[model samples]
Target: MLNSCKLQSRNGSKPIVKQASFLTHANILLRCHRQAASRLGRCACIRAKLEQAEVATQKTKDEVVVERVSSTGGSRKAFAKAFTAILGLKLAKPEDLDPETLLNPPFPRYQVPGSDLAVQKLRPYFFNRTYTDTDVGYLAFFAAMHLVAVIGGPLTFSWEALEVCLAGYVLTGMLGISVSYHRQLSHKSFRCVKPLEYFLAYCGALAFEGDPVEWSKMHRWHHMHSDTTADRHSPRDGVWHSHMGWLFDESLNSTRRDANGNMKDSLSPPWFYKESPEFYSWLRATYMYHQIGQAAFFFALGGVPYLVWGFVIRVLLTMHMTWLVNSAVHIWGEQRYVSNDNSRNNWIVGLLVFGDGGFGVKLRIICQCRQHIPRHHNNHHAFEYSAAHGLEWWEIDMSYYFIRGLELLGLAWDVRRPSPSQLVAKRIPPSPSAGASR
Candidate 1:
């Protein structure tokens, strides 16, 4: 039953599903070109000369990595083309998809638009805006531990003991998931060697969000559509929808294949998703198992407080905080490059999530326009795989610093930064100078 769908090649050469896998490789290579072309890291500062050139001018070998983002950009345009051709497929078309649609599905036929508009008015309230399940799961676990504490009365009293939870959560969640795993490993914002890369992925799993495959897949989708109706979790839709609500609801999740039945394996973690689902399963299960198993061991060896603060509360806080970036950063910060969507630069967010995981730093090089070209993360939403964020020097970004450290340690190589001329094209003229300054 290979019914050709909207995602399928209209001419039917091959399923676009096949094209999804190389998204990462394609993105990285394109980023390299953008950086090399810009010369952002060269010797200069602020408003570098913009070098506008066809990304194709680079050698084929170099350009081969960045693929043709659906000419439709995971939007309703892409969705419509698929929907009309496929009869029953419920792909939302561009016109059909608006920021308000999620909160009030006009098509569900709000018959009594006047009579209280029950569904539409109520829809926004319908979502769980407060601490989500993952949030609840986190807090509940900690509360349960507290109750257990009062019930069992463990004999341990020391504030220093509590510090382990702080250190561990900060180290792993910040360095591991946000920085190493999601940002560097999955996105390739900067380079890293196998050892560091593997460690990053490992700690990411320890965060217990899911597995690497799942995390990266969802992240790629976010970049693919960004603000459009198809965007998995866009704040533009609403704060509740963007936060963690998407994780619980299937509708907000990404569909792996296009109308063509092509799978998005390439966007998945290296080797784990592509070479062997079996290995990924093993990694996923093992990470889950030891996370629980180790806690029990710690309880037996160290005591219940170790388990309560170190495991339960720490996990609960860590996850929600990590997710806050998705829910908060994009919606709160100031937009330096005017790409689309609500993405912005929140300094507290960067501090909270390890320099906003390097995007800002990479952008700084791209936006300089003299020594560095602007990356314009707004441009990134337009084109996700490109590695620059288009931030300026006055703006501070930490993720890039850590990546640089990896390079210094020889744990990472092929570290790309923009050149001078390339920065120019990505630059925006200094306004009242209303952005973050490090």
Candidate 2:
């Protein structure tokens, strides 16, 4: 929102400091003269000039404040002052100012309290679409991929191609997206050596969800501001908005841009950026090209069948599953524990997402495959870094099994967990079958 004001200035022969001083004395004189002069005479002579001088002083003060701010690399506090001073009038002290003026103004903009950026944190206007050219390009790509997947997936159906599709799904969807992107990168749920870690992250990049760094930062932001206006994929924005609307919405991108532009004054610690290795950062920066190369390789190897199944179908399926966690899981299923956001556990979504299959007849046989993620997903929201999303005998998380298998092989280590006692302390309700199983 912008505020426009017009103020007339005098072509003064004196320095601003001297003019300000003269005006200050003139205001005092005007006040004294008002008592003696008739009301009509008093109004005619000095009222207009008095108001103009006051505007000039306020403008000069505003300029000095903004100069101080710009010299120091800028800050939210500095910008807030500049925003008010330049665009609108500041209210006087509580004793003198009208309460209404303080309550609201013709145009209002503010910096989010405690945010470090100098950019005004204007409230989100959901209807005011802010899509950029990049977002439109992504939409175009999505449409093209879907069209190919629909037409080619049927025409090129074969046992060999189906096998390829299922293998790629398990590798890219389960290990790449679920384990690498959601668990390791998003939550730091476990630690692995850099070589293995980056390799898995590369697999995630092949999933075409976005780059590793972008995924990690967005997830962190989601957790930090879940369900609020700042949350990138809050279900509160409606099912479509939470599921995929946020991907194209400029709200998330704008926040990230502001963060980068104001890093010097950012309140977020340096460790957030330093957590990822240089190689991973480089991959993330150029990940679009990497994905294009993957598509080209698939095309060269097996033609349209390979391209459709490997790139198009794989990406489409992975996107839906990932979106389910943000949308269906929040809207359906029971909330097991008190949480800050409306995250839930939908068994149907979990079964489809975390299950694995290598060879299935026409690939539809694996559609009903089960995974234990939904049984313990609430624990993920409660204990973010815990490797145990399902920390019980009946709660069977296939992803956890894979992580454990890797730990036993010494390929992955430092598997973080919250003890059963901690779960009880968090007031997590025990399952009805808990005692019977024990």
Candidate 3:
């Protein structure tokens, strides 16, 4: 009986030991599998990061190539060898240049206007007719002024009338539009004492572009979305659309809404307007009255001649010249910098509008206030914050000179400009030999 009991105990112990060994082997296998999975996950994460970095690098390389093509101009082969040597990118077949591609994509918040809009059709003889009551009034006023200028200008051709027209052109076109509305108000390139600032703004108002706040807002928007479909006055749309057709488009009266039905704050009122809302509001409300008052004063001062020459012809000339800045400059002109938009350094437009000294004109004449003006519209686009548009010494900018004069008088400060390093950084890289020489 004792031998039988011993045998049973031994058998049970053998099975128990085998079960314990099997459990140990299963745990070891599970741990190894988990570790292998962990390593694979780590490798995948690393690969993803590397791919992202490569994509970013490739995108940067593409942009550099595009900028090279834009800045250098001419056949792609002209810069292809230099570009490849510099960037180590394989040169592919050159693609045809598309101006639209050169421009930046529209702001994420911007909604493109539909093609079916009446403004796009642009009917002749002002017959498209989408004007609100206020727009109609504006159209009528502008029409009347234009008629008087065209009809009465030659009829009342006197040296005195011509002198008055030229004087008004200098005061309102140069001081008001270029110095005040453009450089000072729109760009905030320089600071002035409040009195001087207000005086400059009032001078701009006399040009009859719009109130200071509204004009600056529109200009800022232009810079923000230049050459894109969102641009308010891009020549890509049409020369006439950029020039004077935009003025009649009533859709430009207010800020555009986004997909969510919220007004886009991208074109919010300028800092000056936010700082002094009441003043700008009053200025906007009383803008038309100021023009009317000026007309009355001109009539009272020198009768019909003063009205035609000082107010009528002056406004007409200023309007067309300013419009040409939006039209001719973009269409013609040379591109000195690789800006996203198609802004050009149109010397002829600059001569007429900004009083830029024309070809072969002496610098002395520029300083004497004979042809004092702004030039280098592309430079303005390239360096938006710069108070000085004329980067080169010979490229005279009277607007910048005005700002400098104000600074000398202690009336302007905090004037902004591109440093030498910044200018070099933005410039297109020269050929390898030229770069080595530098």
Q: Model 1: residues >4 Å from true position, as ranges?
A: 1-158, 251-272, 275-281, 357-396, 432-438
| lDDT, candidate 3, 1-438, per-residue tens | 687778877877888989999999999999999999999999999999999999878855543332211222222222334444454545323233334532332312221242211223222326633444334445656788888888999988789988998999988998899888888888888999987888888888899887776577677767777766566676665567678876655454232333343322334457776566666656666666788789999999899999899998999898898888787777665565667877776777777766321112446664753332335887788888888887766776777888899999899999998999888777645458644653
- For candidate 2, the per-residue lDDT at 37 reads 76
How much lDDT does each candidate structure score?
A: 0.52, 0.62, 0.68
**Ten consecutive residues with minimal summed lDDT in candidate 2?**
355-364
Off by over 4 Å in 3: 1-131, 251-266, 355-375, 429-438
User: In model 3, where is the ten-residue run with the lowest total lDDT?
Assistant: 67-76
Candidate 2: stretches off by over 4 Å = 1-130, 251-276, 355-374, 428-438
In the range 97-136, model 1's lDDT, one tens digit per residue, is 2335445553333322222211112123334333222333
List the lowest-lDDT window of 10 residues for candidate 1: 113-122
lDDT of 2 by residue, 34-108 (tens): 765767676866887888999878855543432211222122223334544554545332123233532342333
Best candidate (score: lDDT): 3
Considering TM-score, where higher is better, how would the candidates rank from best to worst?
Answer: 3, 2, 1
Q: Sorted by lDDT, highest first, which candidate order results?
A: 3, 2, 1
Predictions: Cα RMSD each? 22.9, 23.2, 18.4
Q: Going through the candidates in order, what is the number of backbone clashes in each?
A: 48, 0, 1
Clashing pairs in 2: none
